[model samples]
Target: MTKLDDIDRAIVIATQGGLPLVADPYGAVADALGLSAEVVIARLDAMQQDGVVRRIGVVPNHYALGYRFNGMTVWDVADDHVEEAGRRLCATGVVSHCYQRPRLLPDWPYNIFAMIHARDEAAATALVERLATALGPLARGHRVLFSTRILKKTGLRLGRQQGGGTPCSG
Candidate 1:
């Protein structure tokens, strides 16, 4: 496993809250960390290559942007075909996020979860219907739970900045 030192950890922390809106955002981070912009950019690139960071991008507020309807579509797919079905569902532009999660049994346990968004309920429902048709009869048991409110959405905190040491756990 690759381990990050103080400098690497600092770079990760600095970039997590969305890149600064500037002519040279990475350069801004480098200045904040007292390092050269080239070094910060290089380290971030390396971190991504090493799988330490999945992506560096903005987290847009879809609702504020007019995507008022968001739904969590859960499917109870047979274990053998989960991956195939998931890939197919993800291929749709309407499906923003898709993944296979363990079923929580009676209370939950649908296995497949997808985050879908649209301008309104009707549009979201139509997209769901399209997905169900694509998945065939297996999608008959799927459930769509449209979101009523957003409780929270924030960046993951990987580490702390204490004792002049590396701040993140990764």
Candidate 2:
């Protein structure tokens, strides 16, 4: 594992929620940290290369973007073909997230899960059909579990070091 220095920790905390929405986001963070914009950008790049930061990308709010209808499409695909089926579905540009989870036997048999966002129920259904057709016979059965409410989403957070003040604290 890579160790984070004080400045790196501060950078992580400052932008963990998200980068400032401004023309120069890195500059904004640098200003808050009493550092230069170039330093902040370089540090973030190093952290990303070191795998400390998985990714820094915009996370759109589907509901606010007029995609009110979204569903978690689960499929009961053969264990031997789940990986290939998932790759095919992902290639269709309709799957946001795809994963293979263990089945619960008689209760739940879905092993492959993919997320789809749409403007309405019809669109959601169409997306499901598109994914199913992409999988062809590999899709033994499937289910569309629609989301009912919005949940807060955030990136990983690091707690204050023991016996030490937080990196963001002066």
Give the best candidate by TM-score.
2
For residue 89, model 1's alpha carbon misses the true position, in angstroms, by 0.3
Off by over 4 Å in 1: 106-109, 158-170
* Residues 15-124 of candidate 2: C-alpha lDDT, one tens digit per residue: 99899999999999999999999999999999999998999999999999999988999999999998899899999998889999999999999999999999998999
Highest lDDT scorer: 2
Tell me how candidate 2 scores on lDDT.
0.91
Q: In candidate 1, what are the lDDT values of residues 76-163, reduced to their tens digit?
A: 8888899888888987767888999998878875998888888988998899898887788666478889888866667566665543
lDDT of 2 at 14: 90
Quote model 2's TM-score.
Answer: 0.91
Query: In candidate 2, which residue ranges exceed 4 Å CA deviation?
Result: 160-170
